[model samples]
Target: MATLQQTEHNKTVDAKNFSRRAALGGLLFPAVGLFLGGCTRGLTTAAAPKVAIPEGRGAFALRADGTRAFRNHELVDQNGVKVRFQDDLVEGKVFGATFQYAKCEGICSDMTQQMKKSYQLMKPIMGKPVNFYMFSLAGDSPAEMKAFMQAHGIDNLPSWRFFTGSSEAIADIRWAFGFGDPNEETDKNLAGHTGMVRFCNHKLDKWAACPAQGSPESTARLVVRLFPSNERPQLAGIASKIATPSYPMKNWSPAKPLTANLASQL
Candidate 1:
């Protein structure tokens, strides 16, 4: 019943209202989408956790001077060179020692593998004349030690040396180095031996110990700690490049404390 002009005016009003509603709907939908997107993004970020930095054991500190003279025991190295403790092994240089036997099926392999990794980490500073010595606990022959070193890819490494001596000398060295009682019967089928790696800075008369059974990176850190501060930075940088292994807490106890003198430090 409305006139043509009035009808036109109503249509125009309805169209304006519809246009406003459509525009509002468009704005509302985008706002809701943006809100949802923000929430989703926040959730995703929260769910992807960052790797936590391991708790450091404080600054590198040396414990009490617990060094004992390496007795005048005769030993033959993997290279068939006869080495004496004073003239070859410690002679006012930084050195590290770990126990191994060729006949063991147990942790000897793991220890050697870790040592190889440690060597790789320390390779940059090998020129500093840092040395590593592996003492045979089972009195392995030089040929046997050479085979072990070759099998572990460390035979050709100039910085690492393998040594073996008579059973009596080996026992005396083991006792002096605090590698636990040498008389304990070990399972030949198991990797049964002291899994410790001991290192010393003869110039500083500082020494420390770490489990060789640990990750190569951790073992490398311990070895680097024995180096003088000037030589440590490079080795530490190399160690950082290696990934740390993540494993559940081990139920087993170490055969001996890493350092023979940790108690004295305390």
Candidate 2:
């Protein structure tokens, strides 16, 4: 009888050991699965596809709000030439414009520098006529604009023009461009303004804007992208060579932020 009891006790002990092992294995299996799952997620995130900005085809459309915001207002260029905004600046050419003040010590300097670089890049393959205009938010005079350009070591590129106008007319231009409050104060004791480079293929009705703080490469790319593919067959090869600019982190108040993917596409 004792021998029989011993056998039964041994069987119970064996069963208990098996149950413990099974329970440990169940816990370990889940832990292993979680670790593998985490690794897989990391890999997937690392290998995620980057967003490419479309080229070769016109992927972006001009904003109706921007087009409507423009008016046929008159302003003066750097050469002291009196010109209308619609007829002179935006009528027949590919145009790019920026809001700046000669007295501004903040982003305007960076903006002009970037513009100069973009001008250099675009001047080569621009194919057709292209123009860049800097409209003074502070109502700088032609002399003041010229002095500012000289101080910054900016050469007079054929495609670029610095412009100023009466405060009311300037305000009208500012409003039409949809830049921030023309009365807003800037860091250099200048009027408040927007820091953006607006570009458009007026003939094609395609327009877009980017932060003036962006790299010249990106800004130039944006300008180049505005050209219709069919209009500039030569651009196909040149567009492939230009590097996309990195998206700016700083926001132009009252204007939508330019995304990295969008900058890449532009």
Number of the top-ranking candidate, with TM-score as the measure: 1
Error of 2 at 85 (Å): 1.5
Off by over 4 Å in 2: 1-70, 125-127, 181-192, 233-266
lDDT of 1 by residue, 89-174 (tens): 65356767887888778788888887787778777655355677888867678899999989888888877878888765665455
- Give all candidates' CA lDDT scores: 0.57, 0.55
**Clashing residue pairs, backbone N/CA/C < 3 A, model 2:** 53-265, 184-192, 185-192
- The TM-scores of all predictions, comma-separated, are 0.59, 0.57
lDDT of 2 at 65: 31
Give residue 260's lDDT in candidate 1 (0 to 100). 60
User: Model 1 — which ten-residue stretch has the worst lDDT?
Assistant: 32-41
**Per-residue lDDT for 35 in model 1?**
6
